[model samples]
Target chain A: MTAFLRRRSLLQGLAGGAFVLVAPRALADLGSRLDAALAERFGERRPEQGGVELELSRLVENGNSVAVTVRASPDEPTPAALHLFMPRNPEPWGTSFQVAPPALAEFSTRIRLAGTQDVMAVAEWADGRLGATAVSVMVTLGACADDLYLEF
Target chain B: MRRALLLLWLLLALPGHAEPRAGQISGYHLLGEELQALQDDDFANPGMLWVDRGQRAWDAAAGASGTSCRDCHGGPERMQGLATQLPRWNSDQERLENLEGLIRNCRSARQQAEPPAYESDEMLALTTVIAHQSRGLPLAVAVDGPAADAFAAGRDAFARRRGQLDLSCADCHDRHAGARLRGETISAGMINGFPLYRLTWEGMGSRQRMIRWCNEAVRAEPLQPDTAKALALELFLAWRSRGLELESPAIRR
Candidate 1:
């Protein structure tokens, strides 16, 4: 399957078509998406000093679904909203969560990462100030996609 | 006859830990604090994503009937405590059937849709959702009557050493559960959290996949997923975790 893609890319090159046809959709531009997600979520709400705790494995065995735990210190007002994102995932807008005070501002879930990258978590504390933290993870192989369109 | 009976007892107990108990610890106890906390919380566990997907599929119409799983099983609340009794004895087929097998059978026989492939996304989602229905319910599969032979086979498989490593399930999970193997602690192997999400897989997988992974890890020929041998092994593990509550879609590292 790989060899076929390579040969097809060569033929496309000869046919004057650029490599864009063979490039993965996910491989296109994750940086802009990440920025967009950050901008949309934060919107000039600068993160306060240390309150959010991002728990994730330092070394991820795979990129398909890495377990992540984000918790805010139960000091005073607990976190109200928790937003999680991976800059390298197919989509940077992973998921937004609601954290109740009684729940102690904790959010946990599995998420996909496309490559080695920092997993970022931002929490909106009850004081309205935002607290954020991140952990870097190394992934071996990213998850395989069936929708990997190959230009014929 | 007395001497023969004594020898038989000795031989049966010699292979490995084979005693059936009323209950045991769920593998959740074996995980790290973070992983354990993840399992304890429903919102954060990654497996919930698959469960949501499964819920969606449950309501989506498919097959010739153009009906969703919700049409039959209704809601997960109605089907609680179902996964604990899986790998059931199918009297009609004269064989043991695991949860996945039953799901497929339903797809073919009832749904009239081509059953999804083993370990496929559709199958895993459905299995996870269904297994989640039994969450917190004690594992209680019957091993009498027609299921007795399969249970015995499972017990044998649990004891027999396999692979180039010359190890058995008992060697790591039973005898040396608290001990470290290559820096990782071995816990009593349990299956309550089957279709559980492994951090390594970053996705949900079945108990068959987990069994096959262990087999390959020890350089043993992994059995085909859902095969008779695999079903027997799964049945054994389920019985081993007899008293633990179902933790399907549990998180793992």
Candidate 2:
């Protein structure tokens, strides 16, 4: 009877330990997805926080598409390319724009939103280093209905 | 002879009596040859593959009853000019009927086929043919009476803000006309050119497609492509572009 009681206590301890171990890892996984996407695109060099701006609303009713604007730092030379990423989307990389030197310092466009997700924008400078920034948005209504074609 | 003289004198004295100028209409802007060329190149000339697809769909048999659009309307030519005046009051139904609504009605009443969704290519094609027939005619959407109420509803929809960004249609199109957004210059929010060939879309698309794209841009749940609200907005836009020449196949960046 003592052995069975000890076994039950051990099982309870294991379950408690498993919960503690797994919860943080799941969150880290989500963060790492964004980090990995940035790492792959921007490489080992970490981008500076200033000069690049990402404008988005705090609340989104639909998660299908969202408007985004990226502005390069005026102090630095105009960025040659701007890359956008949505961490939670099925495809994180939304689009990349190549800006001519004479062009304006800002680029704006629309992007697909997967859900309440973190969006990142990285600017690739002429010298090859990248700059990045991120924002979090809340989504209420999900886009892309399952039975879209069923209306017919 | 005295009565005839009196009638002539009265006709001459009528208020502002003068012969109406030939081609004189309110809000008419004549384009020079060069501008006309540019306008045509930009908007008028393009292949309408979707319209062709719609023509086929109209004739193709479908549904349990196996009927086609041809079974009722005869064919494409006979159905011309039908779309130009649509979204009109349907006395039979006692409601307004846009092109898509009419198509849906026809599908149920005659073709026995399931009606395509509001913004489906099938509906667009049928609408294209109908609008194409009135290519040169001035757009004449009734804005008074019950239709006026629809126009007011549409305007409200256009101005309402929702989504994450909380932007309205007026914010970009009305406020920022002639301004550059990204790489492209914004065009006036005109519906004269629809079923247009946008470089971005890379194919023929309707004004409703553009509206959906805008809704998506703002991170709003886009309404069904052919929603009544969208139709109402189209009616409002059509009224707004009343005097502009219809440029169905215009190109855009």
Candidate 3:
């Protein structure tokens, strides 16, 4: 009876240790899944770093959809296209806007957030390089986790 | 005979000119003291505390230059009537500038300081004081000339549909104005009273913030606070209610 009790205690301790080690790996795996989804959609087109401005709140009260704006930097010629992506969202590639040249480098729209995550935008310049900016938003309320929909 | 017929036609037009909606247009009148009491209550109201904090920040100095708003505008009282004609076309910048932008510009150019964040308390306070100055004046936002393109763009944005819920601005305010939504009567999408004190928001929020809230409430996503489309809609709403008197710090359910 004493030997059996000691074995049970040892098994419980091993199980606890395994949980602590595996939980973080699972989350990292989920994150990589999101990144993989985004990469698959974006393909070989790597987003560049200058001439685009992305504006968003550093903190979001709700993550259902946070307002986002992507504009061409004033110095750059107006961008012909702009793309937005949320790496952690179920659907990573969200929306793209086709802009007219000489258009104000300013566009505003909203996007869904899966959780507290980095939201990135890439602006395709008139010249081929894509400019980008990213902001991490602390989302207190997760995105529409439940399937409830309200109709107006 | 011709003159008599003309006289009859003129008489017919007279009755039509008489106020058709006179009976329905009742005015709420209170005595001067009563109105003053209401205004005082407004000032001391807990809702105004946000504005009060803004007032304090407006006078406080910050940034690398360490200059306060008092350095330029000489404080709130002197800066009245400033907010009424905002979002005006700035010739120097060659773009439409809002109150927040103007505050930042003032800090950058006059104070040699970095502009406060877009929604910072300092910006709100300076703007509140400016809006306070134009308190009783009618709203008169210009919608023509170079602003016409922006106005058209804004109107388009208001009409556009996107987001998971697939809703538009008109679906609520325009179509359902005055209808009760969750115990509150929806007022017309009027911009007459802005920087308003809302029991729901519990703070003074601009029309732009309200616009963003509407988007979120409908689960239709939201645009950035400084987005051009939102600004354009703001311009359009300001123009729509051009002759309405400004009612800043107003109480709303």
Model 1, residue pairs in steric clash:
A65-B202, A108-B44, A109-B44, A110-B46
Clashing pairs in 3: A48-A130, B80-B133, B81-B133, B81-B134
Task: For residues B1-253, write the lDDT of model 1, one tens digit per residue.
Answer: 5345334433443435446341244556655555677777788777998899888887888899887788998886676887999888999999889878988888888889999898888998888998998888999998889999999999899889999988898877666554555334455677888889876655688888878777766768887876787888888888888888888888765
Which one wins on lDDT? 1
lDDT tens readout by residue for model 3, A52-145: 7788877654354456778877887777788787877777777888888556657776566777777777787666666777777776532222
TM-score for all models, in order of appearance: 0.63, 0.49, 0.51
Q: Which candidate number has the best TM-score?
A: 1
- Compared with the true structure, what per-residue lDDT tens digits does model 2 show for residues A57-81? 6665335435578888767678888
For candidate 3, lDDT tens digit of each residue in B126-226? 56656766767877777778787878877777777766777776555455443445334344466756676543444566777767766766676666666
Which ranges in model 1 have alpha carbons more than 4 Å from their true place? A1-152, B1-23
- Candidate 2, residue A110: lDDT: 54
Give the Cα-based TM-score of candidate 3 against the true structure: 0.51
TM-score of model number 2: 0.49
What would the per-residue lDDT of candidate 2 be over residues B106-220, giving only the tens digit for each residue? 8887767778776666777777765665666666678787677777888888779868889887665555443445333344466766765543443556667777776777778
> What does candidate 1 score in Cα RMSD to the true structure?
14.3
TM-score of chain A of each: 0.67, 0.74, 0.67
Best by DockQ: 1
Pick out the ten consecutive residues of candidate 2 chain A with the lowest summed lDDT.
Answer: A143-152
Interface RMSD of each: 10.0, 13.2, 13.0
